[model samples]
Target: MAKQKTAFVCSDCGSDYVKWQGQCGDCHAWNTLKEIRLGPAKGSGRAGASVADQRKGFAGALDSARVLKEIDLDAVPRISSGAGEFDRVLGGGLVSGSAILIGGNPGAGKSTLLLQTMCHLAKSMDALYVTGEESLQQIAMRAKRLGLPTDALRLMAETNVEAIVAAVDELKPRVLVIDSIQVVHTDELTSAPGSVSQVRECAAYLIRYAKQSGTVLLLVGHVTKDGSLAGPKVLEHMIDCSILLEGSEDARFRILRGQKNRFGAVNELGVFAMTEQGMREVKNPSAIFLDRGSEPASGSAVMVVWEGTRPLLVEVQALVDDSQLGNPRRVAVGLEQNRLAMLLAILHRHGGLQVGDQDVFANVVGGVKVLETSADLALLLAIVSSFRDRVLPTDLVVFGEVGLSGEIRPVPNGQERLSEAVKHGFKWAIVPKGNAPRADIKGMRVTAVAKLSEALAALE
Candidate 1:
């Protein structure tokens, strides 16, 4: 028998090291190094086999180099995931020979969404569902409870990578789903499942098989406490697309956003509502996020944000209260804290609103996270309204970036945003001067502001 070999690997960055250290040189994460045992070398027993035979499970073929212009550029058709919202986030549809990683918190309905999709796709194509975390009985029970057609879809409960690949070779499935890569292990490595070495190797082998076989691979991944995919960072790079399912525990809605996509645009958003039946796609997502009461309230302002190819209208809420402590508290939910501090300073400097001694709290309604600068003006307006105990008009919509010099900056896709707001019956809009439409839009009044002071005056 060949002697076993061991090496230290960083859990955070997947960096290999000859010896264990306190800190990883690449990622600088402290105490993340873990020992792993490697398998024997290839061709250990078969001495006469060629190099190609020894690397049977590896993906790809030997081909002669060709000129870039001479290579054919035929477009490959995409497979529909059976859910319109899901397909939208995937840049229209799922591409063959692609590896997609989807992660989310527990009870976020990651499994439910994929099961529903596979059941629908299996009606027309050969699809396989492999579960490493759940049992075959549990899956069948869920499907039966959800009233999914169980006749066509193939199911397997296995965790060994080699066995799964062997079954795939025999079945020749056009689409395959590994219900999480963490629990799946391989015979090549002695490390336990979910370890850095195991996840990295198993994903590589499966991705290789998918690429060579032209199979659509959907991988369900677990999220860390911080809501990021739980595995080696390289797992993200090896896949064709990386998406995340986001929703709070108490919230019934889930948002699927693509963080990385090689075939389509990134930052695309998809909305779904968890029902007793299963996951239902929300056609009008903006309505759900903008579901406020009939009466207008203080500290609330509406804003239009561009999400991928569409515009989303969401509400921004703020609370400003007198601080009893020497140091006032600043809290921001579903928005960046540092940006809130910066916006507060701009409000004081440019808008002449002094609330430094007050406790400021900001929140984006419906649990939607706003990462763009278009929410700057809306957030400042909400803060000012709350400070003055004034209620803004319910028909008003606001969007613009506030600069350090108090000038309002324009955001991309301005016309589309205003049109979306208008379609939703927003009669008034406060936008940057550059975003103002050349032709006046019917049923809507536009207030184009050049500076922060001008935006504040528009409120009066």
Candidate 2:
């Protein structure tokens, strides 16, 4: 019998070391290394020859090296995920022999979404749904409660990766879902389930099987407190696409954003609303996000922001009040805090609006995060409107990137943004001079600004 080997693996970065240490050399994280025991050496009688041979060429394909130009350019067909919003985030649809990782916080409906999708997809293709965290009865009950078609989808409650692969080999399903990678374990490693070693090995074995079988693999993952996937950082790199399901428990809306994608565009957003009938796709997300009151208040402004290939019109709100603390509070929700401070400085220096002694609060309505710089002009204008107790026109829209020297910079997809705003009945727009349309846009009045002072004057 071969002696059991042991190694220390970093829980944070998944770097392995021969011996234990206080800090991980790779991630530089303190006290993250944990000991993991290997079962045995391959082909050493303990692991057996069959297991060793299987790992030799897990992909099950061997070909001679060829020139890049000789490679086939035929597009691979995509499998529809049954949900339009879900399919939108996945480029067009799910790709065969591809691994997709979806992570979310607990009770964020990771299992619910997969169950809903699998039930619909099983009607057309051979699909298997494996549950490591829930029982078979529980899944069936939920499906029935959601009024889903329960006759077609195959269900299995298994945690062992080897057993799952064995079942997959016999069933030959077109789609396979593991809910989730954290609970699955492999027989080759002695580490507990959800450990770094267990997750790494189990995902590798399953992914290899999926690739060899030309099956679509969907893995549900858990997120850390900070909303990032909880696993070895390399786990993200191993998958073809990585998506995050974000929403609080109290909120009915959930946002699925693609953090990584090989088949589709990154940063693609999919909106869904939770209801009694499972997850319902929000086709016109812009409408739901822009549902405002009849009366437009001061400090409230509308902005056209680009999301992936489409344009989104969201509201930007600001509040400027007297500060009780010695250091004035600068708070921003769903927007960068540091950027708000910088924009305030520019407003004071160029726009001649001073709010340094007052507390400034900024928020993007509808829980949509504004990462693009196009919200710079809108945010600054919202703050100024709040300080002056002025109400901007409800039909007006704003978008531009503000530079340090107070110059308004043009943003990408300016034409698309204007068109979307026009569709929503916005009759006026404040944009950078570079983004101004050469031709008239019919009913929309375009106000082009080159500097911060010019933008401030437009508000008057």
Supply every candidate's count of residue pairs whose N, Cα or C atoms clash at under 3 angstroms. Answer: 0, 0
lDDT agreement of model 1 with the native? 0.91
Best by lDDT: 1
Candidate 1 collision pairs: none
Name every residue pair that clashes in candidate 2. none
Q: Candidates' TM-scores? A: 0.94, 0.93
The CA lDDT at 290 in model 2 is 85
Q: Where in model 1 is the C-alpha error above 4 Å?
A: 1-7, 36-59
Each model's lDDT comes to 0.91, 0.89
Model 2 has a clash total of 0
**True-vs-predicted CA distance for residue 22, candidate 1, Å:** 1.6
Model 2 over residues 252-332: C-alpha lDDT tens digits? 999888899999998999999999998999999989888988887999999998877789999999999999999999999
Off by over 4 Å in 2: 1-9, 14-21, 24-28, 35-60, 73-75
Which window of 10 residues has the lowest lDDT sum in candidate 1? 53-62
lDDT of 1 by residue, 1-460 (tens): 8776778878777788888889999999999888877664333326787766555543444456799998765657888888999999999898888999999998999999999999999999999999988999999999999999999999999999999999999999999999989999988777789988888889988998887788899999999998778988878888999999999767899999999999898899999999988999998999999999888889999999988889999999999999999999999998999999999999999989999999999999988988899999999999999999999999999999999999999999999999999999999999999999999999999999999999889888
